[model samples]
Target: MTAIPPLDPPARLLMGPGPISAYPSVLRAMSAPLVGQYDPFMTGAMSDTQELYRQVWATENDATLLVDGTSRAGIEAALVSLVRPGDRVLVPVFGRFGHLLAEIAERALAEVHRIEVEWGQVVPVSLIEEAILRVKPHVLALVQGDTSTTMNQPLDEVGAICERHGVLFYTDATASLGGNPFEADAWGVDAATAGLQKCLGGPSGSAPITLSDRAVEAIRSRKRIEAGIREEGDESASDFVRSNYFDLGMILDYWGPRRLNHHTEATSMLYAARECARVLLAEGRDAVIERHRLSGAAMLAGVEGLGLTVFGDVAHKMHNVVAVEIPDGVPGDAARGALLDDFGIEIGTSFGPLHGRVWRIGTMGYNARKDTVLTTLAALEAVLRRFGASVPAGGGVEAASEVYSGAAG
Candidate 1:
């Protein structure tokens, strides 16, 4: 029998659109021993994980917990539980993630209404409010920051509009969570979900979510107790949910004091998620956000100095990621390959309509730093030159250094 070649993972500087780079501490935490799912220590660890996520999300939602899947799983659980069939759901599309919201809402059989804008721009709050007032949706779904377009939709005003219209508000913060400012409670967000893979610096298995009382009430109204879990003396049944594994109601019961068995909790992933939150909160949210903000600004300036134009409105751009146009003569994919092969760096390409037209550079979580920014800029400049884009040597690195030094003073 043939044996697999020994996998030698080269050290990579992750400056990509996502899965930026996990912190060494988080990686070390994952290497620790695993415990039984129902062990007493495991239950205690579960409680700690909930508390850690609550702090990171800045919410007191008692139902705050980790879903045993990727960020999309948490998204599905929230949407499926809150949006019943025939309910009016309003989705505003500004980029790829907006399409994601619409797709999920469609599967829930919602009467979905959309107010769309161009790819690089976010829809105005007035337009969203007008749509909500006209359609009077039962739930309003939005993505706080759509990384595809490098735009962040202003959410505070929309939240207020939802309150006035009696519509429940839900948002996906998967890409923006720790690297940007997010106030789940203050923004009046009813339900929000995020992934550990991005700014959290953890593996992709666990998704952290927080739900307000109203969201809980909505899920409670649609709860279903499974046959195996139902006691013989129980007289009442639940309103059957659309999907079993993605059911938020059943998940809540499992995480609650009753501690019923659901999926075997991804123990290592949970530990990593907990540690990610621990590391971030230990440094304070504002400081961590500021780190990403500064690094991202430096990257934008550096890219511009290299004769590249950034995509989207700079004023409304996300703090951790930048999208830059691929120059006319440069082959985008080839340049990316050069960066990885020659510099041991990983950056990202755009998706769908924007693919090959732009490249996305990220400064997120543990990877948001001066050294990473400087290294990436230097490498990008060299790679673009290799592709005959004619970038001046040291131009990108020089501009980035200027930004960092100026900020220091």
Candidate 2:
């Protein structure tokens, strides 16, 4: 047998769209000793986490909880648990994640309907209302932020439209939740799912989710007691949720006072999720959002100062990520590699229609700091020059500093 080295990873400053640096406190929380799943402390921690996420989502829903997988898992759970076979689901596809919602709905056996705009733009509320009226869907699935095009779809009016049409409204907030303004209750959202890696400053294993009472009712209607756990008088629905592991009804029982056994909880991920919420709340949710806003502004100014043209409608761009057009004659991937290899910093590449045409730079989560933004811009300026692109000396950092200076004033 050959000897292998112990795990050691390079220290890279992540300035990409997601999976950015986790908060130091969250990392420490994950290292804490574990307790049995049913132990009082474990349950107490779970309850505390639920309360924290309620504040994070700005909702008073009692059904707020964590899903044991990534953000997509949360999305799938919401779709599969609520949409029965042959139910109509209307997804307004502005970018990639919206298509993801529609695809997940399709896999859940939904009769999916989609209305799409150009990739960089958002679907207008009027168009969405028209679609809702035309399709009369049972559920309206949308993405609050789609990183592929760096667009943040306006969701405030869509929820009201869904309500008027009696459609359940759900949004995947994976890339936007903590970094952007979201009001689950005020927006009339039926369900919202998010991950910690984007703006909550944690590793990407657990998903925090909240459900309106109406969404819960829809899920409960499809509840099924698993075979081994079936007791006398336990009724199972004919259209029960297909996946046992992703069953929100059973998961809710496990999280709620019922204390039913589902899967053995991911204790470390639970801790990380808890700590992520705690740190956000301690910093004050609005204040943390403001941090992301300021950081994003600085990065934008820096990129524009470097003579890079930004993609999409700047007015509707998300506060946490931006897409910059790859300068002509610059090998996009090669430049990104040099930035990583020489500066130990990592920015993102685009996806879908944007692939190889633009670079996606993120100021999100723990990496959404003035220092990180300035550092990334400085290194990028050097890389651009090395790649035979024309960039002014210190233009990027100087422009970024001006933003910070104005904010300080």
Candidate 3:
């Protein structure tokens, strides 16, 4: 039998939509020695992480905690916990992730209703209000940022619309939380969830979530203390949350002062998530958001300077990713491969209506920097030239430099 080799991976600049390079500090944090789940230090670390994420989400909800899974897990937990079977859930579909929210709601047995706009467009708040008035959904599940179309759906107004309709507002901020402006409480968000992989600058695993009192009330109404832990007089609801692992109510207990055992916590990921928030808070939230905005602006300018057309509404595009139209003669996949093989840089391919038509370039997490933007643009220029596409010499870098310098000015 052949012996397995040591785990080693190639170094690539991950300028794709998600799972971008983790922060150096976050990586170091993950390597720290693990302790027992209920150990004092472990519990302290968990408490600290919860507090940190509260700032990250800009909310004071005591229920802010980590879900022991990916961003999708956070989405499902929020949906299943708050939505009972036969409850109306209205999802505004702007891109792929929006559909994901609707699908998750469906799995939770929600009577799902969808209002969609074209792929590159956002669902207007007025349209959403109209839908809310008509459908009168109990929950409004929306995606804050959909990486698929590089659109950041404006959420400020929608929250009020939901509030007016007494809808439990939940947003999946997996792709946009740290880098975008998300005022969970001020925006009247009843529930919100995010992952570390995007703007939080960590590897994907743990999902940070927050719940308003209204959302907590909704979730607690369906809480089922597991049979093993059921105490005398403890009662289970008729509409108990179906999934044990994705039950936010139980997960909240595990993170809360009670420290009730649910599952063995992923200590490394907890450390990673902690450090990710520490790094963000140290830089200050608004300052970090500005950095992402500047980096994203540079990347967008760079691509446009390369004579590439951007896909979607420029005004509505997220500050972390951009979709550029693929040149007519160049093969999208091959060019992406060349960028990877030759330059060790990874941009992303499109999905659905954009499969072969556009390339998704991301400036997110640790990769949201001036240097990464400039390097990606340079590499993309060379790849385009090699692929027989006409690209201006030094155009991408020069344009990006202008944005940086303009900011300085």
Which candidate number maximizes lDDT? Answer: 2
lDDT of 1: 0.89
Model 3 — TM-score against the truth? Answer: 0.97
TM-score list, all predictions = 0.96, 0.98, 0.97
Residue range 233-298, candidate 2, lDDT tens digits: 656554778789999999999999988999999999999999999999999999999999999999
Q: Please identify model 3 stretches exceeding 4 Å from their true place.
A: 228-238
| Candidate 1 structure quality by residue, lDDT tens digits, 1-409 | 9999999889888898887689999999999899998998889989998998888888989999998899999888999899888789999999999899989989988889988999899889999999998999999999988889989888878778898889999999999999888988888999999998888877788899999999999998874667557545656543346788888888998999999777788889888888999999899888998988999889988998898999998899998899999999899999999999999999999888899999999989888999999999988988887778878778888998999999999
Q: Ranking under lDDT, best-scoring first?
A: 2, 3, 1
Model 3: which residue pairs collide? none
> What TM-score does prediction 2 earn?
0.98
Tell me how candidate 3 scores on lDDT: 0.92
Single out the weakest 10-residue window by summed lDDT for candidate 3. 229-238
Query: What is the TM-score of candidate 1?
Result: 0.96
* RMSD value for candidate 2: 1.6
Runs with alpha carbons beyond 4 Å of true place in candidate 2? 228-238
Whole-model Cα lDDT of every candidate shown, in order: 0.89, 0.94, 0.92
